[model samples]
Target: MQWFLLGVALLISGYFIYGKIIERIFGTRPERQTPAFTNNDGVDYVPMSTRKVYLVQLLNIAGLGPIFGPILGALYGPTALLWIVFGSIFAGAVHDYFSGMLSVRAGGASVPTVVGRELGTAAKHFMNSFAVLLLLLVGVVFTLGPAKLLGNLSGTSVPVWVAVIFGYYLIATLVPIDKIIGRLYPLFGALLVFMSVGLLIGLAVSDKSFYAAGITLENLHPQDLPLWPLLFITIACGALSGFHATQSPLMARCMENESNGRFVFYGAMIGEGVIALIWATLGMSFYDSPEALNATLAQGGPAAVVNDVATSLLGGIGGILAILGVVVLPITSGDTSFRAARLILSDFLKFDQKPITKRLMIALPLFAVGFAISLMDFNVIWRYFGWANQMTAVIMLWAAAAWLKRHGKFHWVCTVPATFMTGVVNAYLFSAEIGFGLPLSVAGPIGLASSSVMLVWLLMRGRREQDDLDTPAIAAEQA
Candidate 1:
């Protein structure tokens, strides 16, 4: 309990302190016009207030990642708390702030365009496909999961619910930003907040021993999985998810001023970190031990555990409402995932989205691909998402580091975390069954080598760019 409280405090403090530092480093200019106003299309680039954009951005990235990821991460014990606190403060928030702000500066471009501007054309092309694929995966996964849940609740079939949800996604994808998403998101945001806060109060009032033991760095996984890279990968969203980079630009297009970038982007990530912290604490404290939680997870998955906890902690009606909040998470993210895919494809093809026909030209093909993938086994597709998600973050962070270096700001703020996650994702790729399936002894060093190469290249490039900037000044002084 002490650890959880301290973690929450640290996350809030991070927003005020570390958040401001990054905001200053990015040099947000309130006087400048934002893309939302300059490039207002009434569709994706519609202007919105800071408060509305903050909630929209929060829901855009929250998804099931924070809730499910941390519940799984709790298998590693209290060490999960440390990662949630530090990772969000330093890495995740920084990644989000820059991703959104860079997009805002680039006239509401997608993540690929932002990366291309800083990292070069090759990166832009790779990210264009990579980000679109991830968003589609998110859309499909979120779709099936929610459809299945609604099926169970309503006594309908999964296929029926799926068609209904996909239909909603199509409309949300095609419509103006202010029409559906902008209006409904605040209510969704309210439900999410109520659920988390209600659970916290429930924990306080319950007689159950919520804290199994004092905070420990020891591995508590019943399966005895190694903590190094596995814990980090399992707890991506709360810590430092790459997926947020793809989602940040969605809100970036709606921002009214450059100054709102920190509050809407960085602060929203911090808000997500809080949600992750609550879920992790619940996973740890609700069960008798790590073994018990593992058994529960194995038996019914994250949603089952969420149901048991909410029902036990809150009463019947409250618990049902809380569970509804959880359902809202994936659905909200799914619609935006498709929405973002449409925007990314439009940016890539240089197609105008003002016409509904043009929006359908990109969106129809995406849903066709998403619906096809939805028919296959979901677990196989999700296995790649965690790794791919972190991989995207690594790219975005390096791009941000490059942008900072070019502007003579503090690049280390991004470079350090970028190098760390680069190693983490690579390490997961090599060690996990999805990739090489190598032992950690070999994979760990390989990951280190990969990150080291990136860090060295970044430093050398920063030096060259700095020298280029200095050359004109030197010639003037000499004259």
Candidate 2:
């Protein structure tokens, strides 16, 4: 309990302290016109109030992530709380801030475009394909999830719900941002807040004690999995996520000022971290032990745990509403996933999105592919998403580091986390069933070596560029 309160306190304080430092390093220029003004297409580039944008950004990057991911991460005990707090403050929020702000600076370019500009053309092309596929996957996965839930709730078939959701996705994708998403998301955001806060209140009043006293740093996994990379990957969205990088650009196009980047981007990630912390605390407290939590998770999955916890804590009607809030999570993010995909394709094709026909030209194929993927067994494909998601974070972080270096601001804030995640992703890739399937001894060293190589290359290259920029100034001073 103390740990939970301390975690919440740190997350809020970090937003004010560390978040401001990041905002300063980015040097947001309020006087400079933003994409909302410069590229006012009324489709994606419409101006929105700061509060609305913050809520929209929060909903965009957060789906079932902060809830589901942290529930899983809680198997690691109180240490999960630490990761959610520190990771969000130091790494996740920073990653989100730069991803969004860089897009705003680039006239609201997509994540791939921002990455390509800083990381080079090769990266741009790779990320273009990677981000589109990831977004399509997000669209399909979120569609299937909500459809299944709605199907069970309404006694409708999964296919019917899928078609219904896909249709909504199309409408949401095609309409102007201010029309559907901007109007409805604040309500969704309210439900999300209510769910989290309600659960916190429930825990406070509960007869049973939830927090385990003096939880240790020791590995608490039932399967005895190493705590290093797996925990990090499991807690991606709540701590750090590459998926947020893709979503941030959607709001970047709608933002009216650069100064709002701190609140909208970094603040959103912190909000998500708090959500993650609540769930993690609940997961640890609600169950008897990590083993009991593991047993329940295996039998009914995270959704079952969510249903049980919410109902048990809040009672019938309140619990149902809380569950509805959970339902809203994926739906809000799913629409934006397709919308982000549409924007990414439009940017890659150099097509104007102002025209409805042009929007369809790009959007139709994306939905087609998403629909097709939805039909097949996607569990195997979904298994790979965790790794792909984190890898995207690594790329975006490096791009942010590069941007900082280019601008001569403090780059380590981005570079340190970028390099650390580089190792994490690499280690996961090597050890997981999806990748090389090597022993941890082999995989850990490989990950370390890979990150070391990247760090050396970035440092050497940055120094050369700095020297090149300085040479002319030095010569002019001498003359």
Candidate 3:
């Protein structure tokens, strides 16, 4: 209970303090024209209300990551609470703010274009493929999880739900942003907030005591997954995620004012942090101890926990809330992931999305690939997705750090966290992760060597244009 209170306080205070610091560092230009105004193509670059934009952006990034990831990450102990508060404030929100601001400055460019501008051509080419793969993986993961739950909820076959979800993903990925995503996101956002806030209230009224005893630094994970790196990767979106950076530019193209960047990007991440901490608290408190949560997870997977919590906490409305949390949220994220994939590919190919044919030209092939991956075992894909997700973030953070340095602002805000994430992602890859099955002693050295090489490359190559302040090239680089 004590830790839960502190987590909520920290997440809220971060918006006023750290969120402000990032805004000052990025230096948003209120007077300048945003891409939606300058490049209003209607199909992609449509101007939108700030509230609508915030809701869409929040739902886009909010997905199952914060909820599902936190429940699993709670197995690591109370430390997950610390990561939710500090990592979101320092690392995750910072990454999202800079990426969104960078896209706004670059006239609503995709993340690859933004990376190319800051990190160079090699990184751009690398990110072009890497970002697409990440989106497809997320799109598929979100699809499988939610479709299964919705099938259970609606008493339909899993394939029926898959077909329904795929149909929606096709439309959401291809249609104009204002139609489906723009209008429905506010409703979805309300439901999401209600679910989270309801749970918090339930925590207070319920008989279950969130045992602060077994969830401290001394009581490590039952699985013995070392906290050094596993905890960071386990709770990627709740704490930090590179996936948020990719999704931010979608909202950047619609933002009316640069000053709202913190509200949309940084603010959304903190919102997610709050949600993550709530679920983490529930996971810790609702169980006999953290170990019971782990045992339940191993026995029945994430859906088990979500079903148990939602039903137990909110007795009457639990069924509806369960469907919303386990089903609707992922479907929202899944569709948007496909949308981001389409936009990234369109940006790379120099294709115009103003034409419906052009939109289908990209959407058809992307979903085909997603369909192929969806056939794989869901959890297997998820494990790989987690590592790959953070790896992408490490690159984006470095790119954002370079963006700050070139603009004559403080780069350490991003660079320091980027370096820490650098170690985290690499360490996870080196350890007995995915299929490596290597010992920690051997993995540590391998992780360090890989991270050191990437850091050196970023410092040398990421700043060629950063220091070249004489050429005002921001306008010329729009995607």
Candidate 4:
């Protein structure tokens, strides 16, 4: 319980303290016109209040990752709390803030273009392909998962639910930003908040049975998965996700002021960390023991836990609301994942989005591909999505580090986390049976050594390219 409370407090306090530090480090320029105004095409770049942008950005990046991710991470123990709190403030929020602000300064450039500008075109091209694939994979998985749930609720067939959901994605992807996303997101955001807050209240007042499973130094994960890299990767979106970097550019094109980047980007990430912490605490403390929770998980899955909590703790009207929250969170994220993919591709092709025909030209083929993937076994897609999500973050973090270095700001703010995640991704890819068949002992050292080498290389490059602190670093690295 103490760990849970402290984690909650840390996430809230982080927004006020660390958020401002990041804002200053990025040197926000309110006097400068943001892309929302300068590039207000009304298709993807339309100015909006900081609050709306914050909410949409929140739903865009979060999906089921923060909610389910933390619950799954909790299976590892309270050490997951450490990753959620520290990683959110130090790594996640900071990454989002810088990446969003970088896009704003670049006239709403997509993340790949930002990477190209800061890191190099080769890095940019790699990210372009990697990000689009990740987005499509996430979009399809989120779509299929939610549609299946909605099917259960509505008594509709899975294929029918899928077609309906894909119809929405098609429209949402093709329409202007304000048409569907800007209007409905506030309601979805409110439902999300209400569900989380209700569970929090339940946790506070419920029997000690709920809080009995508080974590200790001992490993409690049923599978005995090593905590080092697995825990970090498990809790990506709420902590440090590259997926957030992709969504940042969406809000970057909609921000009203450069100074608003802190609130929209950094603040939204901290908000997600709080949601993740809530789910983690509930997942951990609700069970009588780690073994019990694992037993339940084995029988069902993460959604089973959501069903248990919604029906058991928050009964009555709150229960209905809780169930709906679980149902819609993925839908909200899926729509925007497709939307973000469209924007990324548009930027990549240098295609104007002013024509609805042009938007569909790209969106149709993309959706066709995603729809085909939806036909395969979803678990396979989800397993790869998790790894790809973190790998994307690693690339964006390196881009942020390069941006900071050229501008003479504190590059370590991003570089350190980037290096850390570099190790995390490599370790997972090398050690996990789902990935490579290497032993953890061997893969762990190799991952860290590789990351250390890259860190040193980045530091050396930064030293060579030092520039005046008074001006922003806008130079593109050589291809």
Q: Give lDDT per model, in order.
A: 0.87, 0.86, 0.83, 0.83
Q: lDDT tens string, model 4, 49-104? A: 88899999988887888877888887877777778899999999998997788888
TM-score list, all predictions: 0.95, 0.94, 0.95, 0.94
Top TM-score model: 1
1 or 2, greater by TM-score: 1
| Candidate 3 clashing pairs, residues 3+ apart or interchain | none
Estimate the lDDT of model 2: 0.86
* CA displacement after TM-score superposition, residue 220 of candidate 4 (Å): 0.8
lDDT (tens digit, per residue) of candidate 1 on 1-479 = 66778899999999999999999888878987877877788888889998999998888898888988999999988899889999999999999999988877777778887888778889999999999999988898889777766675568998999999999999999999899999999999889988998999998887655444777888888899999789888898888988899898888878888878889999999999999999999999899888889888888777778889988999888988788888888898999999999988887777889999999999999999999999988777777788888899999999999988887788999999999988888888999998999999999999999999999999888433543122233223223
Candidate 3 lDDT over residue span 1-479, tens digit each = 67778878888899999899889987777998888988899977899999888888888887888888999888877888888899999999999998888888877888888888777799899999999999999999898888777765668998888888999999988888999999888778778877887777877898777655744675458877788778888899888998987899899889999889999999989988988998888898899876788888887688778877887888857646855755667877888899998988987888888999999999999999999999999988888889888988898899888777766678889988898888777777878448476787877777777767766765664333443321136445432
Clashes of each: 0, 0, 0, 2
| Model 1 TM-score on a 0 to 1 scale | 0.95
Local error of candidate 4 at 309, Å? Answer: 1.0
Compute the lDDT of residue 438 as modeled in candidate 2.
98
How does candidate 2 fare on TM-score?
0.94
Model 4 off-target regions past 4 Å?
A: 208-215, 462-479
Q: Give lDDT for model 1.
A: 0.87
Off by over 4 Å in 1: 463-479
* Candidate 3 segments exceeding 4 Å error: 452-479
Candidate RMSDs in Å, in order, are 4.7, 4.7, 2.3, 2.6
Candidate 4 C-alpha RMSD relative to the actual structure: 2.6
